[model samples]
Target: MEVKNKVIWITGASSGIGKSLALLAGQKGARLILSGRNTARLIEVQNALPNPECAHILPMDLGDIESLQECVRQALGFFDGIDILVNNAGISQRSLIADTHMEVYERLIQVNYLGTVALSKALLPHFTEAQSGHFVVVTSLMGKFGSPWRSGYCGAKHALHGFFDVLRMEHQKDNIAVTLVCPGFVNTDVARNALTGDGSAQTRQDQATARGMDPGRFAQKMLRAIEKRKMEVYIGGKEVSGVYMKRFFPRLLHKLVLRSKVV
Candidate 1:
């Protein structure tokens, strides 16, 4: 809860929300382990922090499932123990299921869903043994609703909700906390990097995403949720309303989604 002096491991720490969180966490006096595929960029982020020495960059590809256990081992060893694990490394889909190849869906599942699961499972034993650890998962609003042009992304995020929800229930007695963070459209490179029909990046930002919440503001709200140890928190602008709409008025939300030009 108290970020100061806490050992937090943040995946996808090179840029965007993860980078923001890392800087904020560093300012708050948290010892950080920043991980991402871009080693140089991760080091850049570490250097930008308030106390560069307080953060360590651990480059890793979450999609590489075989190496995740070893990654977790290295993560734990960095600070002797990890107080929080932020599952933020993920890719997004920007094409319709009909246009998308099977490989696209598989890649999304492998990187976004399975990678998160593998890392969490690898760290579960340590958390159970400590009986005091937090798993903060950065899912998406798409995880709560199926929208156009994001079938694979939505499915993978939805799967994360199910997994973390169950993890919360199973680990409650163990004193392990699970927090699912569902972020709506945020101003980030996510859209530009979103997977297309052929599993290639979209290379262009969507209008809505470009106008979405600022990554720094989103990160601030995210840290608040983590501090409160909330079961789940949705952070965004008007798009966040969609979560409530889907909850109490699914039919209405469905109609709106069908008519709205999300892209």
Candidate 2:
């Protein structure tokens, strides 16, 4: 569970929480493999780390499911083996199910659910061979609950929890651990880049996200969860209750979320 000196692969490391985790993990003496679509931005993150040797950038589109196995192979070539796989690369949705096109849901599933699962499956053999590995999935609070306008996003994240939870049960003997991280809104470009009904970026930031938790602080909390090898960790400021509310007080929470003006 000790992160220091462990090899960690973090997807979506160009910015936001993934970037923050990369920097913090690098400072903590962990070997970091940062992956994302933006080579330039990933390199910038790599440079900002305290120890350059602690981190390297792997630039690729995780949404390209067909190439994920090759990506895993490429990663194995760089280091001895991957001790942790942080599945964080994902897109968000802002359109209602009625107004959304089929493709919007497909894209969300492809990038968030299918892509993560494929990459994790591709790396399963490595974890089994080594008899130890961690799968740290960055799901959303929406995964635990549902939002009115974010049906697709919510569904995809929900699927992730189910998949990883089962993977944990099935791979326990192999010493493989699966951690599902459910974070609420964080201050990041995620909202601005969220997809609309037409498969276009929302381009507008949500008021809630603009005033959400600091990405660095969120990453710090997430790192602690990973170190503990937690089964699941849900973190947020006030919005953390969204998970509990949905579980214990579904009616009140559902009505409140539907009526909330923030979204």
Candidate 3:
């Protein structure tokens, strides 16, 4: 569907892929609600948009699950209705499972998986009433294949796939669509901001992430997938191949991941 005049609510809109998506969608004439934890940065993104007046900033902390229903209420009030909800607000992990604290795992699951699920659930009735809506989820390649030092991250992402798939199946009659966008690796602060064993930000970029696909380019492809209402789409460079390899050649993928030393 064309984004022109559509009301799109994007979480994690302060930077990275979410920021890029906001810019592109704004240029395409879509009304936007930009949500993230950083109110200042969200404002920066809004001003950067081609049509700042078409955008509204809704600061949110995804881990604050109890407030999501109220957040959704406020979001729907922005445009009277929302055509798409992009579940892109999430955190990353970069520590070995053994070394990672239990708090780190809880934070990962809360922010990356349960947060998205709660926000979506809160907005379900709106979609059902309208009989038309789209849920775009930004998971990761790790969701489909395992890699070292990201056990918790992988688990959270994998759970997104399972939950959203069932959401799609159950809501088909309601005409609500779900699109799972699995990104391999995109040039972003994901690595630098990733949580360590003690639940602290790593604050250092990894070489692979530093050399990943451009965020703008990735956002363009993602928007195309959303417009087509694809059930699932993988974006990024050659790392995307791992998804297929894991499906057909699990042993080979396993060996390659082990050799990569992904820390």
The TM-score values for the models, in the order shown, are 0.99, 0.98, 0.99
User: How well is each residue in 1-263 modelled by candidate 3, as lDDT tens digits?
Assistant: 89999999999999999999999999999999999999999999999998899999999999999999999999999989999999998999899878999999999999999999999999999999999999999999988988999999999999999999999999999999999999988999999999999999999998899989999999999999999999999998888999999889999999998888475
- The pairs that clash in candidate 2 are none
The lDDT for every candidate, in the order shown, is 0.94, 0.91, 0.95
The candidate that wins on lDDT is: 3
User: What lDDT tens digits, residue by residue, belong to model 1 across residues 14-126?
Assistant: 99999999999899999999999999999999989989998888889999999999999998898899999999999998998789999999999999999999999999999
Report the error of model 3 at residue 125, Å: 0.2
Clash pairs, candidate 3, are: none
Q: lDDT at 231 for candidate 3?
A: 97
Native-vs-model 3 lDDT? Answer: 0.95
lDDT of 1 at 122: 99
Between candidates 2 and 3, the TM-score winner: 3
- Give the per-residue lDDT of model 2 (tens digit) for 95-191: 8778899999999999999999999999999999999999999999998988888999999999999899999999999999999999888999998
Indicate the TM-score of model 1: 0.99
